[model samples]
Target: MSRRAFCERHDIDEQRLARWAKNYPAPPRLAEVVVVGELPSARSSSLVIELGQARVHVERGVDDELLARVLRVVGSVC
Candidate 1:
């Protein structure tokens, strides 16, 4: 999805998402699945979870069961 669309849908500024995406590391760690109705201040085209010292971007329509599984892995590693 385009950055502009993401910002509008989530009520966030596009520039911030761009900067975060640029600064974000590869293979992000998904330590948690944050439940947000929306992200107005988010700084990326996708959804991101900030788990203590980790940051993870969630793709469109991620499955809840899968998310829980991923978080389980994060818990083990982190």
Candidate 2:
């Protein structure tokens, strides 16, 4: 989904969205970082990190280490 669409749908702040986009995990190819307000299971906020040209779901988990690994892969791709 487009950034605008995602932000609007989730009622996310435009500035926060911009920051997320700018501070994407190290990998250039795996660029693009997004934080969801709810995890869908219990509405608990969780972070989602994606990679690849189209953000082809490299990894997903609530743990920071896992997310970091995913970003590392993305960084290597960069």
Candidate 3:
């Protein structure tokens, strides 16, 4: 059925629905990455993680708990 009819049946304000739709759009589409060169060696000191459009570079000597927390937060948002 129509959006207006559905909202009316559900006791929702049409204006509020419109505002929510305007404020929160759909999630973005994911893109594919192609690597042409050689990958990093196993002896590299740092590690890189690609989450969505975010690139997290973690160096050596970082705390494991702190890194886990950071990844959790970044993962939720990204």
Please count the clashing residue pairs in each candidate, in the order shown. 4, 1, 0
lDDT at position 9, candidate 3: 79
Candidate 3 C-alpha error for residue 18, in Å = 46
Clashing pairs in 1: 12-40, 16-43, 17-43, 17-44
Residue 9 lDDT (model 1): 79
* Residue-by-residue lDDT tens digits, candidate 1, 1-78: 577986797776887556445443443332234676765444545677666566666776565556655655554566
Per-residue C-alpha lDDT of model 2 across residues 1-71, encoded as one tens digit per residue: 76688679777776665654455554224234465564445443543444446253433344444554555
lDDT of candidate model 1 versus the reference = 0.59
**Candidate 1: lDDT of 62?**
68
Clashing pairs in 3: none
lDDT of each: 0.59, 0.53, 0.65
> How many times do residue backbones clash in model 3?
0
lDDT of 3 by residue, 1-78 (tens): 576996797767887556444433453222354644666666768867788898889887666556655766787799
Give the distance in Å from residue 40's predicted Cα in candidate 1 to where it truly belongs: 4.0
